[model samples]
Target chain A: MPTIVVDVMPKPEILDPQGKAIAGALPRLGFTGFASVRQGRRFELTVDGEVTEDVLAQARKAAEELLSNPVIEDVVNVAVLTESAQNESQSA
Target chain B: MTAQNTELPLIGDYSTAGPVLTGARIGVVTFPGTLDDRDAARAVRLAGGEAVPLWHAEPDGAAALSSLDAVIIPGGFSYGDYLRAGAIARFAPLMDAIIAAAGGTAGNDAGLGGSAAGLPVLGICNGFQILTESHLLPGSMIKNESLKFLCQDQVLRVENNATAWTREFSAGEEITVPLKNQDGQYVADEKTLDRLEGEGLVTFRYVGGNPNGSRRDIAGITNAAGNVVGLMPHPEHAVEPGFGPDSAAGMRLGTDGLGIFTSVVASIAGGAQ
Candidate 1:
């Protein structure tokens, strides 16, 4: 099976309140040196067969039309992991 | 009279009487978590229009939206507001039909105009968010500036009296309505905001204080044809005077929001004349 992944994040100019709150708590929790924190969503899809270029394009379209909102967020990435690559990563 | 069937004159007539208006079928859409569909439907009835219930789960868009003179996407946490406030619900089959009816296509540049050009559609709260997501309207809503869910009786000034939803109010008239939400801060690119202003599309603006730090203090807006409108406050809740937000007089006498429902009915009725 091929693994497809999509990452959706708020536009850089838009405020991320939840991320900001988490960043604010980090200092009190003895964490340091992090410049900032931003939060986003990730969706994973496992195709039953080999993911072709068509599948990749369709995934991008799906992300744009459904998974993410263009007004406030960007679908930053849509990548397919081949079965061999997945197996390699798993083994390594 | 049986108590449940007893007619209580709590809702006052907000429209100017012309020819007797009747049987205008207004559809109110209900998503899984919709909290205000019943109130929206009741408001339609109070305005002398028939209320048709449209379900989000219903897949047949043609049959679901075939007879509506107007449609109201009432407020609620649809799809539990996953991803973004109105993100997931925007793809509901009914919304697809709404977008198609509103003259938008599946392609870019589709939302500018559509076949539903003259049809009246009003979106309140989450519905407003969905309209933006569907690109039926411009702009987007984000988390409130205070970083908390704010609920209150908000006063708004009617800024545009031309839209179907605000036809009953005069320019600069003030109305009190219940507003409640977390992700209610409306924002858009500066150009879109300016265009909305230049075109007189802003139908309502916050009065007294900006509740959620919305850009330009916008509470509501209409599309170019004045048929589609979206607003943050809950107009349906304020239709019945006894159970509505308090008026400027500090009494629970505000039925100002009823005008939004009655205005659309009157607009349709007037057009049919």
Candidate 2:
């Protein structure tokens, strides 16, 4: 099984209004989740390609090349999760 | 304000709406800080259609919608730039007119996916960023290149002039216009960029230099159906003659940004196709 995950952030040069609003609202919401909260999109997808290092590299490339904007933000990390780990997390 | 504000402009030119122009009625919305609505309106007028003014704060202004064929969200910092350039303005009453012009459908309903001529929505500069938040246009607009606000003329080669707003210009034609913004960078994923480029959706590409560091140096982009267009440059500022920036012709000339307004007017005159 193949797993795909991505996080998208507004480029550093670009200000994040949504993030600011969330950060400002955290105190009222009563969730001290962290010192600061940067908002972004997290997408979990399953691909059809066989799990390989090259495939992973290409996948990461695809993310940076088209999935995210290089000027304003950078991709934090790319990971491939196995079925058992996925199921363990899903079940629990 | 609604189109009934007779003090404002009417729909389409009173004269022959021009065979090529096609009598398309496009509403040019104006906010308090709207810096480019005048030019957008002129472009609509030059393109042989009536240019209507839609107010920024209108809970329900059906008159503006009922009298127009399409809408243009001109650029500017609405609400005095307190929250953000477009952050607070996104929830404005006038945008409802725009949302309605774009069919305001959650999905492809309201005839966007169907054969309906696809209500053309052009968002320039701050307007582009709003389109993203509004979920009308794809992608997002970020800060400028040098991290400092910039104001200068930029040249961009029309990559997909086939868009609903850019049909007057050729795909390869080079057009120079003003680009001034702090958070003007455009960011989207590589896959999305590839799809945009692969599918001929990349409308305009910055040439000479990437002033704002837009991803792929994309100056402008369009939605899947080519109806929605969003860009950073101020095309409205370039519409007037003897005004605008210095032209390549060596005089204080400017290319008529009228093509943007005209393209849609022509389409509408042809009966919304």
lDDT by residue for model 1 (B35-97), tens: 888788888887888777787766677567667788899898998998778888887877877
Per-residue lDDT over B193-259 for candidate 2, one digit per residue giving the tens place of the 0 to 100 score: 8998898888888999888778889988888888888888887777666777788665547754656
Q: Write the per-residue lDDT of candidate 2 for residues A1-92, one digit (tens) a residue.
A: 57877776766645665576677789888987756666666656577878778878887886775555454467887888778878997899
What is the DockQ score of candidate 2, to 2 decimals? 0.05
Against the true structure, what is each candidate's TM-score?
Answer: 0.86, 0.67
Cα RMSDs, all models:
5.9, 12.4
lDDT for B216 in candidate 1 is 96
Total backbone clashes of model 2?
Answer: 14
Docking quality class, candidate 2: incorrect
TM-score of chain A of 2: 0.75
Error of 1 at B47 (Å): 1.8
> Per-residue error at B82 for model 2, in Å?
3.6
Each prediction's DockQ against the real complex: 0.53, 0.05
Model 2 spans > 4 angstroms off:
A1-92, B1-22, B61-63, B103-116
